[model samples]
Target: MSKIAQELASASTNTEDFYADLKPFANFEQLTNFDRYLPLPDDWFIGVADVVQSTRAIEIGRYKAVNTVAAAVLVAITNALPRLGFPYVFGGDGATVALPGKYLDDVRYELARTAAWAEDSLGLVLRVTIVPVSEIRAAGHDVRVARYAASENVSYAMFTGGGVAWAETQLKKGEFAIHRAPLDAKPNLSGLYCGFGPIPTEQGVILSIIALPLEDQASYRALVADVLTLIEFSSRRSGHPLPEGGPLPSWLGGEIQRLLSRDSPHANLLTAAADALRAIKTRIVLAAGIRIGRFEPSKYRREMWQNTDFRKFDDGLKMTVDCSPEIAEAIEARLIFAERSGVCLAGTHRQKSAHLTCYVPSNIQSDHVHFVDGADGGYAAAAAKKRRVRLPRGTNGHYRANRSIDAGERPHRD
Candidate 1:
């Protein structure tokens, strides 16, 4: 092992509080400051899960299904390892999570099961794998993480360094591959759903952007900061895609998807009826802005909007914003200029509106998180555009980043 890896392996054994113990920053811009991040212990493992042929799926108008399966990776792992607080990022078509070595077997099993479940239940192939942090260090990459507290009840994980991007590249190359479990295998996907309809743009359009540094990290950070400044200056809520009170749930948007994700292949009449009733109750509560038992609909709506992961940094910067045509054009022009100047590689996609997928562990809790993307194609399309650009030799290439929702220095306000 490398000397840094040796030190990391010996530095600490108390892994339970690895993420919980880190001091979190409230400002999202602090993500560009490397000092805010801490390196993971070498004994930790990074797990990656992604849907194969996602572009094909998205092309056929199954973006919501794609988002749900991607979110399922996080939901399943979070539900399985409830006691441990680990950092994870949600890419539009996949997710990346880091955990201690002790839970490797458990996580691997869950990932395998999740992959199998996706294939059997959702008809999407999920590729999953777990790699050791020490190996990553030995390969001259590192995984450094920071916590951005978007709200009191939720803090999203921000990842820096090149380690995450590297692991993903390896997974795509068929290294450290984890085979899917038996068809009967199921992951704990209790809280996963894509219940809301596509969010109509209040401004003009929904834009998804993915940008990565092509040169040094310093220049990249500066460029990202400038991009963020443009985005913040262009809109009231820093280009947040959701409305003030959060999105209204569609009458039967996610019911079938939820039923399909259950343990059984077929949902019986009673189970389907129960699920529909629950959906109806939820719609009534949110539509009427009423408090049912411990659940406060209005407060939940506000928190949900505040906690949506519309902008984030995994290995690089990824954002999905709602803005007018002028702002979107200006931002695109700036990125094109940056790409031409050899500062970064970037791609963007625009749609009529934005899509949301949720993992609400409970309706009453303020900690629930929602994932955002362009309703038409979102990050997947943006990434495809980015890939069309020819990368120089030794270029790190594109990798999916984290998905935790965070706010910038200017938090979204009603």
Candidate 2:
């Protein structure tokens, strides 16, 4: 199959050939290395929960017991998500979840209820960040999971006897939302960090989520089942729920429409966007790609192509989207076509523009967007499945000497 594809890539200049050309230079190999990274969908709503004082648990000689308790909480929470029609990840000190647009409110409410339960029963503190899926999707990057491992050890050493325990985090990003949860938050154990930008894939969107233990694991898992149920129900709904015939739900369509009728400015923008999206088919693709896991805004983009944010990457084109779920879905569908053609998509940059900006490379065909070597510019032919040119002509200023890097050096990306 690869041989046939490669031959076609070398033989033609059609869109298929474009993919073929991109194939050889494509970064599909990066997906296999996801143990160090993760590929999360954008546009889905998500829930995040964390443990309160994991470090104290270790100090109190409850490390072993707390770990078990934490695991149990995660199990229950994960279980609860599915039941609630949502899907979730059991982060070490916390958990992250995803929900369809229809179930967004239900899931968020349930998570709040569950958080209260966890705090009371498990003696943990739970904080919630209800973010736009677009925010999280923008911060995807590959970090050596090993990097966290090293940091964990260093944190433990600093605390003396009851060193920080190993923990994991869960993250979900999309055109409309981003959700994150961490296992621990102990000062020395782990640092809860996040970023928003593009990931290497068909999507070209990214978001980051991380957590460090702060309290006992017992508190972490307190509301496991409830959270899991919520997610499950939402997932099921995403697949099976019937659309409303005329009247929309109170949470989204109905309210938004009502506001628009009243002539609110934001409502008008949303209405216009919604109409434009439906009237025209936007190319939305889903790609599996790599990410740079850990990031610090201050040190972002110190190196030209080596910047922490996608904005500083060498790529000439970029698009950072902050949209509603409906809008995100439209974009994702278009990308799916690109993915089949083997487009190398990635999560790049923390959000530089308040709204998602689609970068247009000077060399990119008007009809097609080529995702390629950013730091060291290159052209990609997805159907050709190879990276053809090393550096394309007319790269953007940001595409030049690391100068295009983020000026604020502080990112609210994830």
- Candidate 1, residue 263: the lDDT equals 48
* Model 1 C-alpha lDDT per residue in residues 1-414, reported as the tens digit of each score: 754446457555786677888898888887778667777887789999888888788889888888888898999899998777889988888889999898999899889988998888779999888889888867767788889887788888888667776677677768999999996788888878777888999889899987766655667777788878888998768999999888888876574455553447575777777766777777888989888788888999999999999988776788999888898898889889887877777788899989898888887777899888888988878766413222221213222232211211100100
Best by lDDT: 1
TM-score of 1: 0.90
Candidate 2 local Cα displacement, residue 217, angstroms? 33
Compute the lDDT for candidate 1.
Answer: 0.78
User: Residue-wise lDDT of candidate 2 within 16-131, one digit each (tens)?
Assistant: 12211221112211212213221122334444544445434434543222222233333333333433322332322344444444555655554554444344434555444454
Instruction: Estimate the TM-score of every prediction.
Output: 0.90, 0.26
What lDDT is reached at residue 67 by model 2?
29
Name the candidate that leads on TM-score: 1
TM-score, model 2 to reference: 0.26
Local error of candidate 1 at residue 145 (angstroms):
0.8
Residue pairs with clashing backbones, model 1: 89-402, 89-403, 90-402, 90-403, 309-405
